[model samples]
Structures are given as structure tokens and as C-alpha cells.
Target: MTQSADEGFTTRQVHAGSDARAARPRALPIYMTAGFPFDGFDDAAAHFDQGDGFGYTRTGNPTVDAVERKIASLEGGAQALLVASGQAAVTVVLLGLVSAGEHIVCATHIYEGTRGLILDNLARLNIEVDFVDDVNDVAEWESKIRPTTRVLFAESIANARNDLLDIASIARVADGHGIPLVVDNTFATPYLLRPIEHGAAIVVHSASKFLAGQGSVLGGVIIDDGRFDAVRSGALYPHLTGTGRLGGSSLAERHGGLARIAYLRETVAPRLGPTPSPLNAFLVGQGLETLSLRVQRQSENALIVAEWLSTRPEVASVDYVGLPSHPHHALAGRYLARGNGSVFTFTLRGGIDEARSFVEALRVITHMTHLGDVRSLILHPGTTSHVRRTPEEREAHGVLPGTLRLSIGIEDSADLIADLSRGLDASHPPLETVEAVREESGALDVVVAA
Candidate 1:
């Protein structure tokens, strides 16, 4: 059963897609099977012809379906599709919407994987991509939109830089040109900011992160706001409005507001075969129950840590939008009123050598590439996520030699601060050297050692 919008967020997260009258199970039961048995030939024919029941796991599963519905409700979207991974979700949505010779206007700051997907894979397929550096500038976004452009893509809050995209403003720009706005809301989850509510046509998530709070499983979801009218925008999406494998009826005619989801479910996902396991889906569903609690605590911990880092003499800058010093703090407050997200980056005054010492010196924080885990995770983006890009390209995205990205978790603020202090101490020169420098300056009475 689908939950209504009137229900509280936590209530909907717990109750959405749950059937109280059917099995009487408090937890959503995982349908662990490749295929469901048909009662008879008529049932099989109906299931195959009209897509009545779950014919195969590749197409759909009750467990995956429950998670999809839950995420869709949380995101305030008409429908959602669960894929194997976040990359798969992005791939499925773009493939479903665009084709060869088309183009997509994207924000310059985004995940490295997505950047690679657009620049390497999609470009190889003859699809062009133009990146706008300043997403906040309406003119910059509007200027890049060509007639072939079908989508405007950006992250709600970008990964390492903490640049907050003005969702409503960019959505307006997309709306003006009849293009759909697709936002990757992984950093600022639905609890922080629902892109659909801000006029975005579609929302995507790497459910592996905050959605599955423990970072135990990998999953992704694509949510459709149901505002992109394929029939109205038929020129841009001919595949959706035109006839295809679904007999004579078009997807728009068959599913109405749910045309994109129907098309993905019936054709794109199955054909691409990025099937999510039922067990992983069930785990992700369990994670969704505490989404708000975990994210809130993580955000709080992050803000405290960001403040502490700002005061440190060894730190050059903190890239958290929660901090007043950050350039996008005001914009973050406008769009992300719940809390500035936990995942952000900071840089040290010393270069890679200092960064290596800091990362290795941490006691509680885990050195890892993953984010949004229950345990605080940290990594250097220059040599890790952004290694493939040239030095100039890396600098353009703010991946400097001294830069390190941190994903704050639901840990005690004091303990996290102590661990960070330990790392900072290790990264800086010895106290003896500081004392010697103060003595040499003959200002030991006034100058405090680092």
C-alpha cells in the first residue's frame, strides 16, 4: 500500500509500501525468488502481456518494489525505480531520456564517476555534454541549453566542494526551455532537501550512502515528479510518446503521469539488466527507517567539526556549507533548511605530505573512499576519486594536493574532535620547532606556539 503525503516523514518512511492486512508481518517480507509461479496458462499470459504480476526478478521484485515505493514517498515523487547501483540509476535515466546526437547541460561540480560517464562513455556514443561552471547564475545555465539539450543535471549539494545548487532557480531555467531538471540528491537527502518540491522534474540517489545509513549495501533510485509531460514535450521525447514494443499504445498513453517509470520498468531496466538483489533491497529498506535520525546527527556532528577545523592554525580552509565562512552558506540555508549535509571537504596549509600524515594519524576516523557511513570516513580526492583527471582539471574542481574530503557520521562530537585534533597535531611540525621559532623571533611572551 502506498502512503499519502499527509503522513509525517518518519511515519511514511516506516509505513510506506507495507500491507497491514495481507501477511500481518511487521517487517516487509523479502520475496527471494527468481520467478513467481503462475496459477495457469491464462495467468501467465496475462502477466506477460499486460505486466500484471512479477514475471521475473530482473523485471521486478516485491521487496525491491517496497523500497522503491518507500523512496518515492520520501522524495515526493509519483513513482520510483530501484537499480543495482547509483551509476546504474544515472545510466538508466539518461538512456531512457536521451539518444545519440543529443546533448545534456550539466553543472561542472559533480561526482567524478558521473563526470567520467558524461565525458567518456556518453561522448563515445555521440551524445554531447556542455558543463556550466556557475550553476547559480541563471544566464550561464540558459546560455548552454541548445535545441538538442534534453536535461539539465546537477547535484543538490555537490560532493566535496559543498557548493549548493539553487534547485528552484535551475528548475525554472529548465522549465523555461522545456528541459527537465535532474538533480542527484545523494549528499542532501530528502530529509535535507526534496528536489521535486523545488520544481525539479526528476531526483536520483545513490541509496548506498545516507539512505542505507550503515553503508552495508549498494542501491540506487530514480524518482519522477510526474511533471515532464512527454505528450506535451513530444519533440524532445519521441520514444515515450511514440509507439514501440508495447503493442500499439505509447508509454504516455498507457501510463499517463507514470510514463517514465513504466518505460524504465518495462524496457530500459530489464534490457540493461541491472537487477538489485532482494536481500540488499530489504537491508536498504531497514536503513530508510532511521534516515532522518542518522542524517540529522551526522549533520550536527559535521557542523561542530567544521567549526573546530576552521579555528585550527594548520587548516587553510573548510568547504562545509554549514559554516558562515563558506561561500555557499546562505544558499545552503535557503535550500537545505533541515541541516547542511555531513559529506564535505577541507584543505590543509601543507600539501600532499601533510595530508598523508593527517589521514594516517586519525584514530577513530576510517580512511576510506566511501561516504555517509556510521563511522566517520576520510580520503584525499586528488589521488583517489579524481586521479584520472589532469592536474588542471583537478584544480578546476577544487581537488588540490592538500584537499581532503570527510564524511561525518553519527559519532559523539567530542570524540570526533579529539581524533581530528590528533590528526592535526601529527600533520603540523613538532612543538619543539614552534617553540624554537618563537624563541628566535624574541616574541615568546606575545606569540603562542601552534
Candidate 2:
């Protein structure tokens, strides 16, 4: 079916990018050839000039195109580009935008991968990046924007911590500056939230995560709203506004509102060689076929897990936005109406030793660094993911000594609770402390009057 904007997410997920008018295979076929055959010299010359038809896999592929359509449809985007990895997607976007001596204002609540890419990797290219301490503070966001600031970047739902980004507010800030607001919507997949509808100019996803559902294929996707006008935005994006290389028309002049994404597809992604394999693209398509189901299940299971953990004596705090106790629950209610994502971090009652015991005692939940899988995964962020961050930086970001991040999956809640029970038991306080707490507390839950 050629997708309609009116179609529900699940319907579109299953049928988008398919042409019902054409007789084709029910399943998406992998166009595995390195290059497509041309009719003759004239046809080849025409293909080179016309630029729509697929000529080479590195620049374009049928299987990859189909998957890109599905993703763009799902994300409510004008176009999508599938790349090699999530990091590649960010790098491609950066290459498309900022040049040397420019600046990017980003949120500190983002994943470590992006943080490193901006602070460490991008710095090498002389692209300055600054992080805002609070994503909810529009004033703070505005304060960081400079004349050279090219974009505003943040996560819809931050990884590990589950902090919510006030996308509309930040987008307003970006719009005020005549710049685009780029949101990493990996955690809160399009099944849950479409950042574009909330005013974000662009959305990117680590398709390897929830979009793939399984911990298999390594892929990334970038989606644009196709509303950004470089001409209207003044001179912030000269790459899109000025004459193109070889003295051709500028990107915006050539593609109108779709200039940025077109640049990424035609120049940044292909030139950088971040194109995915046909088989990998096919794998991503299969994952997309069940995107809603897997993410919904994970969201539901996550709420259950969060509720159970909150009442545990071994757990000091749960950083899930779904919980009313979260500092930003109101933001979650306003933005993530469907369900809070599954990835969240919580701290143990004790320090790193207790967290280690809790992690090592887990049986059903795998202790791994990866997330957005069919199986529940656990990891200690302080030591595993953010070990490079200074002690003050980690603590400032709420990564306590005993913090453990959980990416809940489609497992039975009871079984997950059972595995966590063993971990809690191993990490439980000493006998004297338990006795003192029991004597002092009299409530069944946190009320502590039982």
C-alpha cells in the first residue's frame, strides 16, 4: 500500500512503502547487486544526470530505499536516510550542517555516544559544542545560542536516566534563532512520540535499538520535517544557501524545504560511505514490521518493573519519567502521553559494591551494554558507559556510585521480578541495618508506618 498520512501507526508500519497497485512480493526483497545494469551509453548518461534511479549500492539501493520510506513514514518525516550506524547518522548530520568555527548547543541529558561525538570527535574538526544543564529550561537553551550556533540538539527521552526533553519549548528556541532543532528520538520511538509534530525540525534514530527490536542489525536513520527554509533562516546555513561546490545551484535552491536531507542523502552519507548493506536493510525492515508490538510490550513491562523497583527497600531511587515521583513527571505527561520508554537508571541503597552484587546476582536479565532488545539488559553506567566522565561529572548527571541502568524488554513481569528479587537479596542491607529499619518503619510501602 502506498501509505496515507491518515493510516494508524501499526497499519503504516506493516504496509508503508509497499505499492498495492503494483504486483510485487509480499515480503520485501533484498536488492543485493552492487550496481544496476543500464540499457546503453545514452541510458547511463541519462541516469547520471537525472539522479533518481539507482545506479550503485553505495549511493542507492532498492531494499534500502524501501526501508527508508517505511522509517520516514513512521516518523512523519519528508524523507529518511539509512546509514551504517547511529554514530554515523549523527556524524552525517554534522557534516551536512556545521563547519569549522561554528557552534552547536546540545542538552547534557543525551547518550554518552553522542556526547563523545560532540565533545571529543567533533572538537577535532574545530566545531565548538556547548551543553545546556537543563533541557526543560528554554531560557537556558536561548542563553546558549550564539550567532554562529547552527542547531539545537537533544534527546526526546534521555537514555539511562529517562529525563524528558521539552521538545516544543526547545524547538521554539531554535525557531526563534532561525535554526533547526534536531532531536534524537531513539528512546521514545515514533510509535510513542513524533518529535516533528511537536516542532522539532529533524529526528534521528539508532535503528539498531528499538526500531530493530532485536540486538542484531547495526543501522541508523535521519529524518527531516522538510519545512526548514534556509533562505528564511538567514545566513546560518551557507552550505545550503550559497552556491554549491563546482559552482552549481545550492542544496536549498535545488530541493526547496528538503535541502538538508537531500544533502545528507546525496553528499554527506554517500561520500562518507555510511550506507547499509541490502541484507541489513532487509533485517531493519523485518524489525520495523513489528516495531509497535515490541516497543509497546517493552513500555508496558517497563512500567511494571519500575513500580516494583520503587517499593523495594534495596532501591534508593528510580529515574523513570513514568513514575509520579520523578522530578519531570509533568513533562512526561505533557510530551510522552503514550508510555515512557523502557530504558531507565536507578540507584541502589548502598554504593558501587551493592550495585555490583545486584548486577552479578541477576539471572534472567542479561548484564550487557546494549539496549532496546527483546531480552532485558542491565549495566552499570558509572563504570561501563560513562567511566570516562570525571567523578564530579558522573555525580552531577545523577550517575551515583550504586547506579544501575535497566532496559526492560518483552519478558514476563513476574519472571523479571523474580530475577531482580535474587539480585536485591544479594544486595540487601546487613542484618543490623534491616532490623533498625524494620523497627523504625511501620508502613508497607514508602509510607513506612506499617
User: Using lDDT as the measure, which candidate wins?
Assistant: 1
Which pairs of residues collide in model 1? none
Give the TM-score of each candidate.
Answer: 0.91, 0.90
Per-residue lDDT tens digits of candidate 2, residues 1-450? Answer: 378899899999987975435467889998887898776788888777758687999989999999999999999999999998888988899878898999999998788989998888889999998888888898888889899999899999986578898888889889988888999999999999999999999999998998988898899999999986876773878777789667978878878999889888888888889889999899999999998999888999999999999998788999999999998899888888778889999899889899988989999999987889999999999998999999999888889899999999999999999999999988885799888778667445556543
How many clashes (backbone atoms < 3 Å, residues ≥3 apart in a chain or on different chains) does model 1 have? 0
* Per-residue lDDT of model 1, residues 71-134, tens digit only: 9999999999999999999999888888999999999999989988999999998999999998
Report the Cα lDDT for candidate 1.
0.90
